[model samples]
Target: MARKPKLAVWKFSSCDGCQLSLLDCEDELLALAGNIEIANFLEASREVIKGPYDLSLVEGSITTPHDLKRIQEVRKISKFLVTIGACATAGGIQALRNFQSVSDFISIVYATPEYISTLEQSTAISSHVKVDFELHGCPINKEQLVEVISAFLFHRKPNIPAHSVCMECKLAGNVCILVSNGVACLGPVTHAGCGALCPSYNRGCFGCYGAKENTNTSSLSNKLYQLGVKNQDIQKLFRSYNAYTPAFLKESKAHD
Candidate 1:
């Protein structure tokens, strides 16, 4: 029998939601386990197999000096490295600190600020290493996560969409919340995922999936301004889960 392809999952500074998304794939995970050797997933199993892993799924942002060094080693050992979720791809909600003073925040939050050792800014994995692929989302869509892993296993491109949430809203036959309700939605510029869940229920999109490819965030922000959305509110919307992503970060700064 052929040796099973080794798989490893790593975490840095995150809520561990993305790792849980894999475990949530209860049935598909069982089938996947049959084909791959889950070499090092601390959340799933404490029994760690040694690396030079065939594929590695990395979660979270690089927020510390230790994380910066460790990710370089992870890249050296993994043949293919895929970053998952907003944290891995765009630095996540923690990236909000990038706009402010880290030292001031640390002094306020920590009992002993001197004891905490961290980078001034939270940054994505790709900012530090060569990422083979990026799966974007706050927690990620499980179906998409499975497709990404399977694509690497089969040596093919993952079939994830690059469209905005507006496409999903149209496909689902939901009314345009921005147009009809005069709501401030990030759907026009945000990536497609979460099945347009918020808009389906008459709520505006929160942009948890990050900015879509070739997003026109300025156009969308202008539309929000036209709809009577306050400038500060517009800035806050763009500075959410995927705040540190280039397109969203730039747009948020425009509002500032």
Candidate 2:
């Protein structure tokens, strides 16, 4: 029989939650194992295998000098490289360092700042090498991960949408919590795929899916202000998980 396609999973500067989502796919994982060879995933199994991998899934951001070099090597070995989660695709929460001084942050967090060696800012994998696809979210949605992987394996296009969460809320028949309950939401500007999770629980969107394609965050911020969200609160909202993304950052700065 011909050898199965090899798959590799890699991590950089991240919380590991996105990679954990893959493990969370308990039943689907076994089916995936049957279709591909687990070549080099450090988070799951201990068995090491050489690569020239068919597909590589990367999590986390490039935050160190070594990480920059390592990602270049990973790209060379990977036929198709997909970045999973906010960290790999949009520089994660750690990327807040992009706005402030790294040394100042290190001093605040650690007793010995000199002992720590970190880049001034954390950046996404695309900054280092070419990424074939990106799965968004703080920890990506499991179903989306399955679809991206399955598409690669079967040579089909992934069905991931680049629309805003407003579409999702409408599809789920969720009452507009922003209008009905007077809650400020990022739903209009945030990417869909969390299945309107927060709104389903009567909470506003936190932009976990990152910025939607062609976002109009300025309009959303204006609506939020009109809904009585204080300017400081508006700033705080955009400064959450996906703060560093260009659209969110620009809006947050305007409010600030």
Candidate 3:
């Protein structure tokens, strides 16, 4: 009998929401296990086997020197590496510290700054090592996760889109919250994945998934200002889960 392909999951610095999304795929989990050997997923099982793994799904950002070194080792041992969620793809909410002094942050939270050992900035997995694919979102959409894994298993391209969230809203038949009510929305430039969630809830987009391909962030920012969104709020909007994403970061700096 042939051995099943080994699958591993790795973590760095994140809220673990993306990892939870895998578990949330309760019905699919058993089906996936039958197709691949589950190995080295600390979040799901205590049983860790030695690698080189067939595939690796990585969650979170690199915030410490140790994590930087560790991810390199993970990359060497994994045949295919996929980054999942905002932290792994765009440096997450913790990346807000990228704009502030790490020393000041540690001093404010810790009794002794000397006791802490951390990198100056939080950064995405791709900043440290090569990534085969990236799934964008704060928590991530579970169905998309399944699609990515299945596509890799079948040797096909994942159907994830690089289009704007506005396209998703249009497909869902959602009213244009921005045009209709003057809401400040990132839907014009945010990547499609979250299914236009905020607009459905009567709130503006927050860009939890980073910028879309060729995003016109400056144009969107100007429009947002015209919609009466305060400069500070606009900065805050870009400073959410994906603040360090180059497009969002550059636009936020332009506003400031």
Candidate 4:
């Protein structure tokens, strides 16, 4: 009999929403457990197994000196590492501080700034390690998470789309909020995973999944400006959830 592949999940500077997406899998996760060795997931179980692990799913960004060292060790132990959610793929909302002075931020957030030890910038897991694949979202869609894990178990590449959320909105039969009401939306540039959630409710996309492959944020920015979005607000929009992503970061810096 063949042994089940070992799986581990790790977290860093994040809200733990992405890890919860896994547990939220419920029955689907139970089905997955039948084929994989549930090795080291502290969120799901206290029992930990020794590595080198077959696959590791890393959540959150590297935001401290300790994070840098820990991720290196995780990289050394895992055969294949996948970064999940905005933090793991693009540094997350916390990356908002990458625009300002860390010292200033510490002084403002903590009474004793000297006691807090942290790096100046928050960054994605891929920035520090060779990532096999990235799953994007603030809190990732559970169906996509299952698909990624299933692909690994079966020895194949996951078929997650590289399309934009606009397509999803169209498919879901939601009236185009941008077209109908001149709303400022990141759907044209954001990666598709959330099923155009906000647009469904007449709200604009927040780019929770980060920039899509080959996105034209410049065009989107120009469009926003035409729709009467203020320049500073446009910059803020780009620098939201997946701000530290290269395309969005570069685009936002252009506004700055």
All candidates: TM-score = 0.98, 0.97, 0.98, 0.97
Clashes of 1: 0
Query: Taking the tens digit of each residue's C-alpha lDDT, what string does model 3 give over 126-216?
Result: 9989999999999899999999999888889999998999999999999999999998899988999999999988798999889999999
Pairs with steric clashes in candidate 2: none
Q: Estimate, for each residue in 35-113, the C-alpha lDDT of model 1 and write its tens digit.
A: 8999999999999999899999999999999999999999999999999999999999999999999999999999988
Q: Candidate 2, TM-score vs. the true structure?
A: 0.97
TM-score, candidate number 1: 0.98
In model 4, which regions exceed 4 Å deviation? none
lDDT for each of the candidates?
Answer: 0.93, 0.91, 0.92, 0.93
Model 4 lDDT on a 0 to 1 scale: 0.93
Q: Report the Cα RMSD per candidate.
A: 0.9, 1.1, 1.0, 1.0
- The better-scoring model by lDDT among 2 and 4 is 4
lDDT score at residue 240, model 4, on the 0-100 scale: 86
Q: Which residue runs does candidate 2 get wrong by more than 4 Å?
A: none
Q: Kindly report which residue pairs in candidate 4 clash with one another.
A: none
